[model samples]
Each structure stands twice: as structure tokens, then as C-alpha cells.
Target: MANIMLTKDQWDALQRHLLPNPFKVEEAAFLFVKVTESGDFECVDSWCMQPHDFDYQSAFHISLRDETKAAVIKRAHDTGTALVEAHSHLGKWPAEFSRSDLCGFDSFVPHVRWRLKGKPYAAIVLTTADYDGFAWIGDATDPVRIDGLVIGDVDRLGPTGLTPLTWGPWEDFDGHI
Candidate 1:
């Protein structure tokens, strides 16, 4: 497996997305960090606004919907990219994956492996405020802590002025400026 990872800068960008403006109630923009067979990590595509609704006629929840699932499968199949589904949590609670998160994994893992020819995949969960996150790979039944990752700021948009700027993967608090 490659040493796949996400930078703090990226996380800051994601936090801005969790806000419930005209978009959150209906959808979520899916982002990811894909590790290639060549052992390099890159932030690939972004699903501008993935619908949060799913089957069962329940209230639209915050999560990767079926359409988002299809998109993930296609990306994995076409590029041989391992999965890394990242999304924002919109509250002050220290970021953690909710039940919906597990549901997402249960629904996606098999399809990812089968569709991508058994490539390893991971899920990245972050807070709306960029306070905490974790990575889940291989065993959707298990979760791993991301050591050395911290959030210095949140809600500031990136160069495009639409995405926030998140920073992480720091050795210590090396004076983040």
C-alpha cells in the first residue's frame, strides 16, 4: 500500500463546505485523496454537489448518496484509483463518523473492491469546523486515528474563493502561519 495522506491545507478547504447555505440541505460536494499504484497521493476530482438523499424515503441526510456511489465506482474503475471518501461534519462535536458513515462504508466497500479489481480503499471523515478526523481503510469495520494531523483554521476559502483552506500532517505545532 502507498503512504497515502491528506494535508492540513486541504482540510481547511473542506470545512467551508459543511455550512448549511443553499446547498447543504440538498447535497454534499465529495472530495478525496487518492493513492495511485505509483505511490503518490493526489487530490483528484470533486463532485460539486452530491445529493444527500438515499433510498427508504427518509429525510435527506448528510452523506454520500447512491449517485455519489456511482461516481466513486466510475472514478475507481477508470483510473485504478483506490477509494478515499472525505466529507464534512457540520457541528461543534469533535469530528467523528456517524452511523450514516458506517452505512456508507457498508454500501461502498464491496462495490469498490469488485469494481476496482480489489484495490485497497479508505474513507476520510472530517468535522465541519475541521477540528478532527479519521481514516478508514480495508476493514470498514475498523477505524484508524490520524496522528500528527491538526486543524489550525477553518472556513476560509481556497484560491477559487469557494473552497476552504485546511492544513494538516504537521510534525508538531511548528508555528503554523
Candidate 2:
């Protein structure tokens, strides 16, 4: 399992973008991250999707415009960084990926790996109070849990506090395999 580390300021900025006031619907973003020597992802920058970036959006779903997707890919290509796709889930739902989200990943992840020359790709789903993440590393077919998050010097996702709900093979939900 790998972790993602970001400065306090970066975390703050990302939260603001993700959980804005009047947040009536889900929002999405692409985080451009560099793999650190210690095998963690360091967020270098992010592109928060705007209204015009999406072809459709509601409280439960969002579809990025083709141009928006292309732009995010291009940015990762230009920056030579791995990509982490992120989005929000409204209300009190757990921060877990939906079946629809997994279906989307089936196509998108392979395309991204090909375009980015086999660089890893990841996704994180955030609710108001928690998050869960997964990563497809190298040629692996299944994803590993993104087990922790380090905000500045604090371990926000460690076992003792704010731990994400377990998903994938470790647990099952809604008949998800």
C-alpha cells in the first residue's frame, strides 16, 4: 500500500475545491502527482473541474467533456506525472467507489496507462468527512488500497483516526465483487 503526501496548504486548497459552500452536486479533479523515492505520491498540482469541463453533473454523477478529459491527460503528459482522479459523494454515503465508477475505470485506466507509458493511475472518492482510494500500479490488474494520507506531518488516515472504510477484497458492499 502506498500513501499520498501533501503540504497543509495543498490539502486545504484541495478541500476548498472539493467541498465548497453551496456544494449542491459532486465535483471532480485531476491531481498531478510525482512518485517519491519512498514510494509515496506527492501532489504537485491539481486541476479542479469546472462547470464547463463537464458535459453533465448532478448530485450522484458527473461526466467530463471530452475536451476536459483530454486537457487533464495532456497536463499529466506535459508534466511527466502520474494522475489521480478524484470526486465527491454527497449526503451521508461512505466514501466508496460506485459500480458505475468502476465501469468507467475499466476503460479510462487502461487508456491512461497506455497514454502515459505505463505510469500508475489512481482514484479517490471523498465524502464530507472521509475518503477512500485505490491505485493500479505497473501491470497489475487489481488495485491496491491507498492506505494512508499524510498532511504535512500529520497522519490523517492512519489506523487510529479517520480511517477509511475498507473496500475491495478486504470487504464487499452492494454486491460489488
Report model 2's TM-score to 2 decimal places.
0.87
Instruction: Return the top candidate by TM-score.
Output: 2
All candidates: TM-score: 0.56, 0.87
Clashes of 1: 12
lDDT tens string, model 2, 70-151? Answer: 8899999999999998888788755777765776776798998899999888888877878878888878867778867789
lDDT of model 2 at position 159: 20
Whole-model lDDT per candidate: 0.47, 0.80
In terms of lDDT, the best-performing candidate is: 2
RMSD of 2: 4.5
List ranges where model 2 is wrong by over 4 Å.
158-177
Residue 140 of model 2 has an lDDT of: 88
List the pairs of residues colliding in candidate 2. Answer: none
